[model samples]
Target chain A: MTRKWLRWMPAVAVPAVIAAAALAGSLPASAGDPLPAKTPAEVLALVAQHSAPSLSGTLEQTSRIGLPELPQAGPSSGSGGAASVLELLSGPHTTRVFLDGPSNVRVQVLDRFAERNAVRSGDQVWLYSSKDNTAMHLTLPADAGHTKDFGHYKHRDTGMHGVMPTPEELAGRLIAAADPTTEVAVHPEVNVAGRAAYNLVITPRTEGTLIGSVAVAVDGESGLPLSVELKARGQEEPAFKLAFTSLSLEAPDASLFAFSPPPGATVKEIEVPAHGTGHWGKGHWPKHGTESGVVPDAEDPAPVAPDAVPPDAVEPDAVAPDYRDPNGALARPTVTGTGWESVVEFPASPASAEADAMLSNDPLLQQAAVAVPGGRLFSTAVVNVLFTDDGRVFAGSVPAERLLTAAAAR
Target chain B: MPSREVPDREVPNRALPIREVAGTDGAADVGTAEPPSDRSSSGWPLLASELAVLFRRRRTWAMMLALAAVPVLMAIAVRASSAVPPGRGPAFLDRITQNGLFVGVTAMLVCVPLFLPLTVGVVAGDTIAGEAGLGTLRYLLVAPAGRVRLLLVKYAGAAGFCIVAPLVVALAGAGIGAALFPVGPVTLLSGDVITPEEAVVRLVLVAAYLTVSLLGLSAVGLFLSTLTDVPVGAMAATIVISVVSQVLGELPQLEWLHPWLFSHYWFGFADLLRQPIAWDAFGDNALLQAGYIAVFGALAYGRFVTKDILS
Candidate 1:
């Protein structure tokens, strides 16, 4: 019996070893491997290096800014109501972005059944929405005056505050926000868009911000941001997420940077107002002037005929005076706070008895409007609109109390 | 072992039937009982029979009636109201007073979320399991209707309900809306106005789009139906899944799951309001629905073909 058992031991041991080898082969090699670690400073440097001028990819963006239920009628005007911010942020939107150098860029925002493309080639930008079959041609203002001043003015006046940030933009802002007030660290490696990525977590040290931390996933090889996530204070899950579902390092085709109105499309020409010289306490405001500021692009041979102007075309110089009431009361807007927490206040309008009576009579409007100390407050996720009893309208990305304070200020 | 047991059980039944027939004239009795050229063997006949049986049911008529009544009630309510509430409902709701045809579009919006999905779920869930519960499925299978063919017939019946339910709502809404409100050129979401003829075409497209949206839920209900013999259980499960998905889709925290959820693109029909017709979401919705159909349809096929028809 001992001899027989010894003879079978070799066979049993060999099969056992083979089974162990097979199981090992089936297991992932990187299962227990540690992620590559780097310092916060190194991560920041990598982010700066990868902020390339030319690149293109498909971006998937989603936002949940904790918005209240909006009234069904939707925003009232072209500028959109307060709920428009919620609408823009709450849903999933796919944007095909091409930045073949910053000056020539195209962003195609795709909706379920519609497509809207904003293509900027050289000085001309064409916005075409396939749904309405409408094409808007905007002639960008000429690169006149100080580029830096104009850049600053554009950055402040673009009304991009509180809007959901793209991956690259959010990455850049996170880097800029890095200071003594922020605790920066490099997180473990994770997969994003099918590529290995390292997350750079930026946590605010300040107590006032609603944001707890922002995590940016940077591609391991290319160093470009693949995704950005933001978590509000006391929340386990990120409140906002924007990421590239797929990306290509190769430069997008040059043809995609150009736009032409399709056949039967109603094309409308818009003249972008130039940055005027008027400065109200360091902030530039558009001055009411007759200067066309329409620097004809040398590439395009078609001259803009004066008669071709639409009846409602906003004269560039006539922008400033429009802010004034019939009584010549100028409602100059002023900015307060800095960076992400900035707020803009528009001068209060003198309340009219007729407007007061109308507000009192409309029960639906009364129900919709939130009563404050002096007026009503309409709030959404990222923006708040305050309508004072004295007829002043102040809108910003701040809370109701902040807007009220701005309204009450002398 | 289970496969072997299935044949063992079936063999005894087959022998008993033959023995009983053998006591009489074996050949004639066998031939009459199992006809070589049964009409049910054909696909079209089976589908027609299945659809007829489905429509004959009281529940089928009741569901369709409930679906059709929604638009009528909505039109009456809107017309009865003294003031046209702005920014209160869907984009088309605000414009219903301008053109009554908008009532049809608004009705589609109201139904697509919950009501239409619930109706589709009930019909699809009942399709296969209902037969099984009544002990008729075994007879149908033995009629040599072919398992695949019978499944397809059931699906077709469910698909029929899906298409008809929305059409009823849209058509009734349009007729009532046109009667109560002014019908004229329609202004699309793009703010560009189009002729009344074009608007009618759009309304048709809206109805078609809504029907396609239900394909995912129908597939889910069909798959669930295959999992159990209880029709009511399957129906409830299908509806519960839809509501759960919608709820999950609304959560900001689960933003990553939105695209994969069936309910995510249900609202894509709104893109039809655009002038040139937004094809991105339209195409995406179709592709997503097709994906769900392929997945769940395969699951149902895989399970049903080999399933022991103990009932």
Candidate 2:
């Protein structure tokens, strides 16, 4: 029996030892290697270098925008409302983004069972949905120049046009917002998607800012950002995280840069109204006559009897200076806080009273919003919007009190 | 010495001549007997015969009936429910009220994860092992149906089940759905609406896609069936593996393993509802199922051919 057992010993022992060694070898050796430390400025410079002119990768974004649960819009509710905006910002979304130079970019957002692709190549941009087999082609204005700085163009275009912000565009905006007032530091090196990265932490120096700090992990070699995390003030955890779960610096296949509506898809062509001399274009204010257009300017306020106003109600314009044009061209929004805590204030129109009333009546909106002293405040995890009785709308990343102060200040 | 004495005792007149003739003619007899069996049994006839035997089983009809009942029950439940809030459930569940065909889609979605796979497992797992368990495998082999050809026939029978199972549910759901609810233009998940004719075409496509998706599981079951003589054990093992794959697919940390899991793209049919019909995931599913078929089909063939038919 002993001899028989010995005969099989080598067979068993050899494989066992080999497997043990293989398991040991697979363990990460990150502990032994000390990362080289660098200053914030150096890291920022590397990040600048990393933002390549053309690149593509898979992006994963998770927004814990602490949005209060809103009532579902019943079939009666019309399309393109504030509820949709909240829906866009309050979920975990995954997308594949490809950028070729500044003029050609494609973003494909994946749904559970569907896909929405926005492809911008040259002067034409196509929005395609696989679910409905519908395609919308938007021809950019001739003057929307083909600049190499696509990030800047995308920000200016998408922000004004109300297009959903792509993760790559959002990352660019966050990085561009960095200024001297931001306290920057380098964190220990970490691995992102199997690649070594250097974390650049940016903390706002100002008070009343809701964001604690923003951390961006830059690929050590490519200088490209691998991930960006935002933590709200007083919170130990990040409220929002956008990261490239997988990235490739390689230029994507050329065919992806083109878009042709597949057969059977309903194709609609959109003519982007030319920009007016005023800073505000058709993109900012609702284009009248357009299908599903924004609520027509409230020049004629909804039939709310003047008696509806209480004697104690404070006039918002009296407290806050009117910064908007009577013709409805909005003054460029003013930014107060820097970096992650920045508050962008757009002077609201008194004409918007009609629009406000319509929104206030929306059961879904009413449920999502909380009554404030002078207005209604809609709060989400990462953003807060204050709609004042005087028709001024103040939105920021800060808390409601911060927005209230901004709204009340002269 | 006893063997020699026995031959000598029987050696009388015929022993020497018979022994000399047997030695010379043995090779010729063997050659003549082999060709007739080889030439007579063609693969198609054998396949037809095997399919007949398989379909004649009461269990096959029972499985088909059970699958058919799923859609009927789903339609009844959805019709009875007061309201299904939009965007609350799987893609088409909310639309069941508007279009009865959506009930079929909802039924498919509900069954694909567990019921469909389990039914497939039962059929596929019984293919080879069940025959062996009943002590019929040896007799079949003796009929000299080529081993590889016999394995292929078994696989084809299981593949046939995979196709028919989904069709049964779809037809039942469509029938019950038409009776219980409204039928009109189908609204796709992409928010695009298509004509009823287009919707029917899509439903057919969905059924076909589902059948292809099930190919992976069928192959896995067939492979497991080749490994064991006990049909129940093979069925249980196949179901367990599918459940394990599904659980692993759900784990975020094991996301890297998702693409390799046979169940990973089972839901890719959802893409077919999109306006342009997103084909990336759909194509990937087809290719992945084909890969699984190739690998496990080969494995089943490799093992079954050399297996001892003790039963």
Candidate 3:
């Protein structure tokens, strides 16, 4: 009797699990929802009606990972300060747009490196390479025609794979697959971002993989994606969740899309790798603009508002006073031990072997490596003081150029 | 006589055939009294009992004692230091303990590419080799114990060492690290700081994951030990394999190749320290390591059970 029951146990468990999964995937749709009959184009058209050209906000992001019991990170909230956060609210296939805002009509495309990030504000799209100090700015063409077909994964045969599918694209595809035959529940609810949103869940019409259904919460008013949760065909728990924070719908200047190189700045055309083409996506930007144009000053060359503060509002008229002069926290150099003595100051550079040696030895100096990048590259220089008692023990970057300059001046 | 599990394909035709023996001492008169031969003559269970005897060695005790002392010493070092910049923090000492654990794990990691899987390789590397070097392998093999039992015994002893050594080192290191380093608030990669209790739990989890990761290497070592005569060669080979894999695992160009290598998951435990825990990478790492353990373990069992014990 026990042996017979054990054989039937597995058979009973499989069908029971299947039924439960089927029920879980097909949550009843609520009333007064009109999205059930819309195709991708029609769905996008509905989105375009209420959507604005641009959205901007302040973003404080904290990304972490690990098990729930022992998580990867603690909460770290850093202030983004007065900087404007921009995201162009668009459907998955809407890759490039000619947006007119704080600066007037230029081109904006979802940034591929930043995982299909929407471009919200600012005229010039500036990106700097950390490895090399090279910078690039992109501009929209005057015609603003859809010259390049973007966001078509199926059109790869025509040598056009613009970028990986956006989160909204995935959500749209899931919804479209389940439209007429199956009803998806759409609910208005608050998401992690503390904003009201329409939560949409799609259940496929046919038999499929474990994740036969998908759910996403889109900001109802902004048309921006706030969060997404996915359920597999068999599982009760969500397989994964992605959340976007600090959403807004403010308009941006149109001119922010136009890119003009500074005079004497070298302009080189580089080909960017297409997404989902192969491993390691391409990085080179399409080169069309020439460097002959006078580089606009870092200051806002074309101010949108009359009250718009100049970009370089914090610049001093003359060289700042040296605080090390008696009144400074470091008044006089106290002679501790007998050796080589002098206050030395130099900017941090990887090329400087001496600075590496000094910084590597002092634990406090390590943070300097990461800090230099967050600020203007040329703004602050590293001030180094060397007190060498045993010359043989520690020979600081022996051929000091600044020391040579001082010696030559004397 | 012994029941063998070696696949028929790998069994050499030139290998010696086993003869039936009536009693425990039946093979003694024929000079097949070596521990491994005796094990084959006796049985697998008897071999396991012999492994317990091998663990009773003074040298094994001393080695374990020394390894167990490292964390305590590390803890003392951390406690004695005046100001531990991030450089001097518990993480650094934790790294030091990691280095020591890696030495043992590397022994195992080295075996995956060439030798048997890691755990088998570690035991196999030292098994006959260590015994042969000590001139006890021949004696043990020739004793009432059969060759198979001797092999099993040695493997069991090594596995016991491998599991115990890492835990002791981790516990000692963490204990010392906690005592020596400032234990107030632990800063994490996510810019969130954790209290001492939370940090302790995370560290313990990290150590436990590391132990699981090392199991594959240990299995490989035991398997390799069966193939070689000198245990040092097996030991050296194991370490070399680990070093090479570690080097290969770091190349950015071959980032895709990383998921396949055993060492790829070595630092995965550190992910636990991150806030919210990045499980995508960690889960992938855990799955990969578990697969390695299963494959290496099966290979070791098949090889040891079937291979000719000429040594």
Candidate 4:
């Protein structure tokens, strides 16, 4: 009888062994050999001096805005097929990023059975969506030069951009625009993507703002920003984060950057009429309007809007500061305050019938938006967008009530 | 689900083969309990007979035909509809009208969560319990089929069903889709268009990936079958586990447990359709399935070897 009972021992033992093996594997690889530490200012200087230009890696991005969960469709096509950037409103996404100096960049947003790619080589940018098998091509104007001014390319992707921001880009933007009212600190040691790094923490001093503090994981060796995490005020967890799960400092293949639309893909050519660069999305993406032909003062896409505002608005200038232009080339995006508490209000532009219908029909948008006295208010962990009844938009990385007050004042 | 009623009838039909194969089981070995090696010594004959019995059933055929009907019904529905569905249905569903090939992919996606698993549960749960329930287990053991060989044979029969279910869905989908809609160059998930030949290859890979995905479930069902004399209970339990695993997989709060769940990668077969097929999910799924088979296969062995044949 004892021997018969012993027969069942294998059942218990096997599963217990397998579970132990899995638990061992999931333990984060020991933060091996911590790198020498640096102060927050030293890390900032390191980022300024960092020059590892050519690299390839995969990025994992997750958001915890407390929105409704994303559909279980499959890394979904980020800001592609649906032409609704809000489609990526929640959930984790995996994007493969490749770069080779200033001339070539490729970002592949992986969906379950589909992919969306944004490839930039020389003066050409090709955005391809495998779900619909469609490709959009845009040629940069001569003045948008191929020199190391990659910041121009970042500006060009103001609205409805297919790719998520690289950790380097987000970290740089946050650090570059850090004002006197912000404090910078550093955690001496940290590990990310299996590499030792410095955690540069930046906190805003002002109150009445939604943002708490932002942390950038700066690679100790190459000074690359391996990850960027943002916490909303009063939240322990990161409200938004984009980080590299793996990294390779070597240059990606040149062939990766040389993208041509697959043979059967429907190709649409976008002609940039005048402003060497303007926002790509007006409404529902790739609007075939060569009609915004008013040649402005050729402004180098100014750093007007505070980078933290994650407005769900489709318009880019809707979040940019509104400074009344004397020449009336383009109405200034109205920013109400300075620094962290700033609010940007949009000039009254009539919403198209199609956009109104689209917004009304999207279940995700409906769930996030609530009725206010004047209009509808939409919110995320750190940003708010109040769609005023009179065809105006008020947005900032502030609470919903602040945005409503700004809308009423306007 | 009326398929549950048919496996009981299978036991009676299988009685004839048992009599012919183990003709000398005269109940003399009932006391000392040495299995009478009255049949052939070779394991192949027994394995072949086990599989033959499983496939010969009306329930297996009914389940397969029902699975095949999914794509047929979908293709016909899409064909009968108006010119443009215009953003209707799930991910690959909208593309079905443009490319007939998408029908198989879409149908597979819809069925993976429910239909494939239900059939797998039935076949696997029916393996041992159905024999014990019909008073035929003593006769088979009296044929002196070693307990290990019988267990392996039962598992093989279950695994065989897993392969057929998904293939039936994919092949039927392709045939119906090609007949109804225009078939042309297949555009992959990476936007790369491949020739029809390559598309067929991708479909086969997807089918194979799905087959691997279900293998773990079959083992689980086989283990559950050993615990009870009622085949229906085992079948229900197996299906419940598959559904529960998927439900747990969907919850974000239990994300730490998701990777360990067998169903976590069930839909990952779609990776086979991508231009440069992502092989990571395939390898991981096979490893996870192997783990399940190892753990549950041993449990079934332990339980079945010790149980006294009373039915």
Candidate 5:
């Protein structure tokens, strides 16, 4: 009997596992349906079973910018003193930075790519580069400088605050634009880099956009992105490649952090004293911009009529404001989109006193990072923006003052 | 002579004339007519006998040897090569060789695109035309063999050679590939990786599919061969047709129509390597290839049976 059972076991066991898998795989999927209520430890163990024995080795990948034939090995931009190609590639440049955390913001330029790169702190700013060896001046907006108000890792329940929607959030937005009933699953996981990451997979329940299903990989550790890949509806080919390099978790060195006036460099610091010259502290009007002179919507709140306010008041009185007024002032601005927000640390240093004086002229960042805090030298500010479905910018503002202050405190 | 008992045992000695049979006479009358020279069994038997005649010519043996030897050479070369990635060599070589949807399809791809199909055309091209060149076609026709059967025997020989040639090439390549590469399992597109044994099973199936693809092309060549008097012309024409189809198939702008083209099915064997085996599309490809074979076969038979082989 035992021998017969052993023979039958081989035949029976093979089919049993397959049967189980088939049944399990075909089970109706319910929203947020947990995978059989197994412990997290058990899930990890099951996943580990299938993973191959990984060889531990660091992979170093370098991609050179393929430039057309050059007669010389030096920089050909004509504005620069002769510099190697590597120097040119690594120099001050604006790169698209995507921070995916509580309130996401796409920083068009994180740091200036130039001979001298400068990072702003509240009361001080740091400037370092090959071009400037001497004391250099830092600049900031006069009234609306960097503030640490918006850079914390606000949890899901925290009210949304950001200029632009994150890529993951955008997935649903885009799908919704094409067809409603599209469902998206967002979860946190560890990526290949061993960093905590937020993974979002969007599937359309009804019709889908040109993009059928998309998975966005956001780094939960740094609240920064490692890569982005777009998967088209029926395409087998990869549509695009987006990646980041030279990621640093630690702040840069302090000595190199501060901006200095380069030797023989003429320093001119323009300091515009903070003054409440307009209805608002800054030149920004809810209706009209300073430069473009574009008019805002009729419903947009405008500066109160001078006669409607009491003599002592600097602004409008909301009490008994015309009820039928189409542009009646609202108490606070509406928060329109989803975003990620997280505080990250960077080195805090200041350029020459002249540079700090120069930064004071900027109207939006006058009070940010006035003094470094003990625990963190950083400040925070909210970034707000609206974008089209395809990630094209409609309107946005990244408060450099807030970002710079936050970096200093951290 | 005693006619009563002698006739029961002994046959009539006098010969009958065949002309008298036409006049309602018996075989005795018909037998006397001159022997019908037209009824002689000279056509196919004569051609079959000429199998030795082919051997006498160095080129025939060379052609056969070349066909047989090329596969061996390819097998040896593939085995000798170390350029392939470790563990993937066999599957890759097998893919390049026996797989009809893959290897066979690729052969059609490479051949049809440039000059490979032309070689198939050469054999087909020479079938009737070569015989005409040797003047043996006329001689064979004079014999009792019908024009249809004569064309058929030639077609069979040509197609048989075509099938055998590719089979040898594929098997040799597979053998070399197996020896050189680590053949334990293969990763398929369906994401289900299989062991070497499973891969081998799939490989065989794929090879059979490739054979089907080849059969269609042979039919096409045979049909083309019947159209021209010059063997070279027929071979070239067939080759040109293959080339044209391949070129036409590559026009991505005409994607919908490409699937209907016969050459479109050339890549069907590649489907075998796909895990979970996408049989629906592969099956459709096979059916399409079968249709081509049938259509071409019918056309060849129709033309050979009815048309004159005067040239």
Candidate 6:
């Protein structure tokens, strides 16, 4: 009997040892964050001076925006699938991003059982959906900045935090627009992707704004933005987050930039006019974007027209030209108030019925919006858009009451 | 020798009664319950006997046939029907018509979620309990197999099933797919084309990955088998764990628990089909499986060595 129990020693010991090792592995590295002290301004400079021109990393994007739970995989997911802009917004997605500069960039949305890849090399862009085995090719005009031309992807893909803009681009916009109503401070150093980073927090000093603060982690060594997190006013959890889970500063294989549709793939060639003549140009809105700037991507920062905002003359309130919305049926889209509290107001469009129908007919709007006294308010953690009975639309990163007040005052 | 069905069960078990697994006979203690002396007998011959007993069972053959039918049925359906609209069905379903090689991949995908785990659960869960249930377990303990040796042989037999099941599905998939669809170059997920030889190599790699993925669950099943005398209970519990792990994996709320889930890397084998073949997930998955094996293998050892064997 003693011998029988003696044999049990290894069984118990082996598992116990493994458990101990696993416990050690799961604990975050206990080393102190090793970085010299830096002020908020210093961190801002770190970002401006930062240019890791070539790097490959995997980024995870997750949102708790309170959108209804949509089935993640459906028949439609196969064709447009997770790459569909709305689909991208709803769930957690892992994207592998490889950038060799403005000329060569490949972003792969790694969906289960399928992948949707957008690879841009020189003037050519290839969008391939592995699910359906279809590829779309577009050749850019010589004059349009490839960086700006990629905006068409975000332009059509309005909503969900500037459609895959790197943390650098998003954080750059926030820092550029910092004003008297903005409070920038450096939190204690934190670690991101195994790199020490200065956590720069940008708080909105103004009241009545949905934005609580935006925190960006700047890599201490490379000065690159490693992660960006946005929190709503009352929410303890970040409403939207994008961060690199793994990163490598080395340039990815040059061959990854080149894409040729496989032999059996059904490839479609998308036609674009040369340079400035096409709507795909930076200064122009892609055809669909002009139809509805109501996309939630329009809420924060300035509109898609960053250059349209005068270089040195940003209104103290940070109001620039409102985003393009040809279908809004209202010309003269304007902003009222200032700082983070600004509300974009569009007067009742001439075609009220069409605009009203557009609002009422939208499935997302109908599902997300709750009827108010005179309008329906569609609210997310970051943006609230109100559609009044008279076909006027008011939207901002402010409370629904603010939008209603603006509508009533109008 | 009333138990003629078990072949050479009695003498070997009595010849090498390990101190740990020597069973107390409630029905008939015919042989001396002596300390283990034939430790050297716990070698290749014992494992060979274990495997022969396993593979010779009609149930094992039936399960193998059922697994092989998955890809055959899938290929025949796709071939009989009009082209499945590109985005309408299971992931690689549409690709199968374009390239016969995809039938193996798609079949593996479909089976990994349920069928493969179910079969693995049966075989692994049957390890000790099936012997115990048949009343041969006690005899085998006295027959020549020490407790540790017998446990090793049982696990090896289950592990053997792990490799063979996926290979069966993959090879059967290839045969039927080639017969029905056109065989040619394969288009990888990265859109790179590879010769048929390379594609076959990739399929084998996929099979290898799947074998690793299921090995962890096999360990879990083996441990569960030792917990109960009824094989069916152990089998159900083992299969349930696989399903639950997959369900938890899909929940975004449990994102923290995901990296630890065994099923987390089940589909990552497709990374093998990428252009340069992303080895990161493969490495992570192998490490995770190894961890599972160590934890459960030890747990099974601890339980089986200490437990009283009455059958």
Per-model DockQ against the true two-chain complex: 0.06, 0.10, 0.01, 0.29, 0.01, 0.40
TM-score, one value per model: 0.54, 0.58, 0.39, 0.80, 0.37, 0.83
The parts of candidate 4 lying over 4 Å away from their true place are A49-55, A70-85, A147-163, A249-265, A281-330, A347-366, A371-376, A387-392, A400-410, B1-49, B56-58, B76-86, B94-100, B142-149, B175-183, B247-261
**Alpha carbon deviation, residue A207, candidate 5 (Å):** 17
User: Candidate 4, residues A129-153: lDDT per residue as tens digits?
Assistant: 7666678888867766643435435
- Scored on chain A only, each candidate's TM-score is 0.62, 0.71, 0.35, 0.81, 0.31, 0.78
Worst 10 residues of 3 chain A by lDDT: A81-90
Looking at model 2 chain A, which ten-residue stretch has the lowest summed lDDT?
Answer: A303-312
Clashing pairs in 2: A50-A223, A65-A381, A66-A381, A130-B274, A130-B275, A131-B274, A131-B275, A132-B275, A133-B275, A133-B276
Error of 3 at A260 (Å): 46
DockQ-based class of model 4 = acceptable
**Model 3: per-residue lDDT, tens digit, B174-193?**
55554444345554432334
User: Which portions of model 5 miss their true places by more than 4 Å?
Assistant: A1-410, B1-82, B85-116, B178-201
Candidates' chain B TM-scores in the order shown: 0.87, 0.86, 0.62, 0.88, 0.64, 0.88
Which window of ten consecutive residues has the lowest lDDT sum in model 3 chain B? B102-111
**Tens digits of lDDT, candidate 5, A218-255:** 54433443443344445454232233432434333333
DockQ score for model 3: 0.01
* lDDT for position A152 in model 2: 46
Across residues A8-117, which tens digit of lDDT does each residue of candidate 2 receive?
45435544654576578567547445556778778778766666667776667665656543332221222235444444455566667777777777776666655666
Which scores higher on TM-score, 4 or 5?
A: 4
Which lDDT value does model 6 have at A75? Answer: 17
- Highest-TM-score candidate: 6
Candidate 5 chain A: worst-modelled 10 consecutive residues by lDDT: A302-311
Q: Higher-lDDT candidate among 2 and 3?
A: 2
Give the clash count for each candidate: 10, 10, 89, 4, 76, 9
Residue-level lDDT tens digits of model 4 in B1-311: 11111132333434546534432333222222444455445566666777778788899999999999999999998888875432345567767777788788888887898999999999999888988888776556545455666778789989999988999998998888899888888877666578877888888889999999999999999999989889999999999999999989888788888888999899888678764566778999999999999999989988987777676
